[model samples]
Target: MKILHVDTSITGPASVSRKLSAEIVEAALRRHPDAELTVRDLAAQQIDHLSSAHLAAAQGTAPENAQVREDIAAGRSALEEFLAADLIILGAPMYNFGIPSQLKAWIDRLAVPGATFRYTESGPEGLVGNKKLIIASSRGGFYGPGSPAEALDHQESYLRAIFGFFGITDVTVVRAEGVAISEQARATAIDSARGEIAAIAS
Candidate 1:
């Protein structure tokens, strides 16, 4: 199996999502001991936001500067990595009730016309449906099904929508929410998420 491990947390070792994602990756490795793993830390290697130059370059225009060329190449590389992976382990931490900008930028590279998705007569059709996606989601507050803050949850929701748009239906979420509520709450949430991971591993 080809596994793609993507980490977007800016908190380094203090990131809960990072810890869970690493554990998920380890479990996946144990399942497929010979799996090839590729790790991409978006916080460390930031992909530049899409600009007019990037759009123009995508339309067959030559890159105007070295920076544009480098950025465009990076975006292509990111898309290639996504396309090559059989399973994806994503570390996503909520920031202001949404995902990090770096992760969004990486996603933009994947949402290409006729590559990841296409417009059919019926509507939009996703091309990359063969891959499995597991999200390690960490949130500071309550945002589950019936929580008061559920409507404010754009992190996991957006991730699901985008990946679904890419035709991926085999998606799983291991979430640790309310981590900032209290020490006990944080511990309970993490312990619960670990339990879910244990099930996945088994």
Candidate 2:
């Protein structure tokens, strides 16, 4: 088995999403002791945002300068990493009711046309398959269904839509929300998320 772990939270040790995601990976590792691991700490890594030049390069419309070429290669590498992994764990925290821009940047790399998905006569079809996605979602407010802020939530919802588009429908989210509501709320949320993580079958 191969596992790809990506942590986008910039809060280091104080990040609840990272904390939960680490535990999730640990549990999975225990179940698959021989699994290979790849870690991509977005906050600590240098992943450039996709730009017009990169797109042009990808489409073969523009000559590849050194930086443009490197950017395109990095995007391909990121996608290849995802494709090579059998299981993926992502630490995603809600920022202003949405995912961090860093995570969005990484998604752009994975959403390659004719690579991750393709347009067919039946409409668009996802090309990537047979992968498991686990998202550790952290939020400062409640965004679950029926919550007042649910409509404003784009974090987990967007993720589900994107990964599902890539044919990865076996997605699970371990969420710890309302961390800023109060100390007790934060503690309770974290504890609950940990329990969920512990119960995971890897």
Candidate 3:
């Protein structure tokens, strides 16, 4: 299997999301011992945000300036990676109740017209499907289904919507929330998330 591992946590080794994401990948590796793994650390290799220059280059409307060429090439590479992966493991830590801008930039690149999705008589249809998404999410506060802060949660919700738009229905989220609440809470959350990962079908 081709497993694409994407890490977006900027906190390095100290990041809880990074730890959990690594564990999740390890669990998957145990199942497919020889799976081909590709790693993209967005925090380390920062992807340029989508811009007008990028659009102009993509549409071939104007001359390809060096920056525009670079952005367009990167966008194509990101899309290629997304399309080739049979399984995606993403490190999605909540930043101010939403996803980090860097991660959002990557997602923007993936949403290419007539590539990942297309408009048809049946409405917007996804061209990409039959892929599995596993997200390791870390949140400072509790924002699960009936939690007090649920309304403020946008990170996971947005991810679900985006992947679902691409016709990816098999998504598993191993979330470690309330990490900043207390030492006990942090331990419990991490442990619980690890247990869930262990229970995942490989």
- Residue range 24-69, candidate 1, lDDT tens digits: 9999999999999999999999999999999899889998799989
Better of 1 and 2 by lDDT: 1
Query: Whose TM-score is greatest here?
Result: 1
Tens-digit lDDT track for model 2 on 47-105?
Answer: 78977787677777864478777767777888999999999999999998899989999
lDDT tens digits by residue: candidate 3, 1-202: 9999999999999788999989989988999999999999999887899777776666767645786677677778988999999999999999999999899999999998787888899798887889999999999999999998899989999999999898888999999999999999999999999999989953
Give residue 77's lDDT in candidate 2 (0 to 100): 84
Q: Residue 176 deviation, candidate 3, in Å?
A: 0.5
Which residue runs of candidate 1 sit more than 4 Å off their true CA positions? none
Output the better candidate (2/3) by TM-score: 3
Question: Local distance difference test, per candidate?
Answer: 0.96, 0.90, 0.90
TM-score of 1: 0.98
Show pairs that collide, candidate 3.
none
Query: Candidate 2, which segments miss by more than 4 Å at Cα?
Result: 61-64
| TM-score, every prediction | 0.98, 0.95, 0.96
Q: Which ten residues in a row have the lowest lDDT in candidate 1?
A: 55-64
Candidate 3 regions with alpha-carbon error over 4 angstroms: 62-64
Q: C-alpha displacement of 9 in model 1, angstroms?
A: 0.6
